[model samples]
Structures are given as structure tokens and as C-alpha cells.
Target: MPALTVLTGAATAAYSAALVARPQLLQRPAGLARNRDARTLTRLVGVRDTAIGLAMVLAPAGPARRAAVGARVASDWGDAAVLGVALRGRGTWGKTVGFAALWGAVCLAALRYDER
Candidate 1:
């Protein structure tokens, strides 16, 4: 369980670093044409994801397991979103199944340390 938690946390942090980078990359390209508020919002989302990821790895317990729990949940959330966008409506149902599987994996990691 501890190993699972550490592995997930490390992976989560790495994922977030990528998430944060994508928007910054866009800010120079097509992002130059995008609405300022929308761009800011996108960057904020990435920052939030990155923080949650770092938190999970650095502080996994005490006061609140919420951050750690949320870290994995956030990763799963992004996975589902990507799958949804990639597939669109007619094919989205398959993406949903994939999301469910991903969620299940996250849940297993969460449950492993969910002493509460």
C-alpha cells in the first residue's frame, strides 16, 4: 500500500508538470490569439493540478488526506476529459468506459491508505 501510494504520488507530480507546461507553450503560439481570461483560466487549472500533485507526494498524511486523495482524483479527471474530447459524443461512451477503469485504479490507490 505504501509503495502504491508513493508510486501514484510520484507519477501524479510528473503528470502535473506536463499539464502545467502545455498551456505555457500555447501562450506563445495560438494562445496569442486566445482570449486573455480563457488563457489565464487554463494556466490556473494547470497550476492547481501541479500543486495538488506536489502536495500528494510531499505531504500524504496528517491534518488532511484530502490533498493526496484529490491528487489521484485530479489525474483521473484529466484522463477522462482527454478521452471525452478525443472521442466526442458518438464515440464518447467508449471513452466513459475507459474513464471508469482509470477511476477504479485511482480508487484502489486511495483505498489502500484510506484508514478513515
Candidate 2:
């Protein structure tokens, strides 16, 4: 579980970085233009994910780890909501939904591990 958490963090942070640095590649997948507003929002997402990823990697296990997992859960749900709103009625919306659901599942699994 710990390893998975770390991997998730790393992956998310990397992906977020890509989105912020070169959103053009994601224009189709994300269904967002590479405009100023979109880039700004994408950078914000990068910042959020970077913070969460770092917390997950650096926080101690037990309570600290659990707290990070909780944060991850919150972040995932929030992302899902944002995606739902932004991607509404869009054909590529499912991609964002799937991304959020995948992370949400990871967070939930981490929470379940914490319960044990």
C-alpha cells in the first residue's frame, strides 16, 4: 500500500507537470484549448498535485500517511467534480472521468489499508 501510494503520487505529479508545461499534447485528451486561461488552470492543477504527491512521499507512516491518503481522496473527488463541470456534454469527458475514478480508487484502496 505504501509503495502504491508513492507510485500514485509520482505518476500524478509527473502527469500534472506535463499538463502545465506542455498542455498542447493534452489538448485533445483534455478537450481544453492551449489558451491563457486553460494554461493557468492547468498550472494550478499541477501545483495541487505536486503538493499532494510530495506530502504522500514525505509524510511518515501511520497517522501522517492516513492524513495524506485522506487528502488524496479529497483531491480526487474535487478533480472529478471539476471535470464533470468543465467537460459537461463533451465527447472526451469520459477520459477525465476515468482519470479521476482511477485516482479515487487508489485513494480508497489506501484508506481501506489504513482501516486494517
Candidate 3:
């Protein structure tokens, strides 16, 4: 579980950094460059993900860890919901949903570990 947490944390942090540093790189299915509003939202999402990753890494094992994992799960679900609504009937939506599901599973496992 600790390994899962570390891996997810690193991946999310990297993703967030990439979004901030080179938002253009996350084009295509992401479609973040479609408009200024989209780009702004993408940056905000990056910031939010960075915070989640930080929480996962810095929180001690126990309730604090559980809370961090819980936050991840919540945020992932929220992203899934938004994708479902905004990207409906699109291949990108499906891909994003799959990614969210994988992260959600990892966070759930971490939550269970923190419980013990």
C-alpha cells in the first residue's frame, strides 16, 4: 500500500508539473488547448492534483493517510463525473474514465491499508 501511495503520488505530481510547465504537451484527447477557459481549468486541476500528491506523501500512516487517500478517491470520482458529462460519446472520455478508475482503485487500496 505504501508502494501504491508512493507510485500514485509521484505519477500525479509529475502530471501536475507537466501541466504547469507545458500545458501544450497535454493536447489531443485532453483538448486542454481548445480555449483559455479550458487551459485555466487544466492548470487548476494540476494544482489540485499536486496538493493531493503532497498530502499522500507527507501524511503519516493512520487517519491522516486515510484522509489523503480519501481525498484522492473523491477527486478522481469528481474528474470522472466531469469527463462523463463534458466528453460524452467521445473516445477521450472513455480513456479518461479508465485512467480515473485505475487511480480510484489504487487510492481505495491505500485507504484500506491506512485503516489497518
lDDT of each: 0.56, 0.75, 0.74
lDDT of 3 by residue, 8-93 (tens): 77777788778766566555555435577767777788888888888887787777867888888889888888777877777677
Ranking by TM-score: 3, 2, 1
- What are the per-residue Cα lDDT tens digits for candidate 1 across 11-91? 656655664666544334222334667567657756765676566667746534555655557566665665456445654
Off by over 4 Å in 3: 25-27, 113-116
Question: Looking at candidate 1, what is the lDDT of residue 84?
Answer: 58
Please give the RMSD to the true structure for each candidate, in Å.
Answer: 6.1, 2.2, 2.2
In candidate 3, how many Å is residue 17 off? 1.8
TM-score of each: 0.52, 0.83, 0.84
**What would the per-residue lDDT of candidate 2 be over residues 12-70, giving only the tens digit for each residue?**
66776776777665666868877888777778877787788777777776788678777
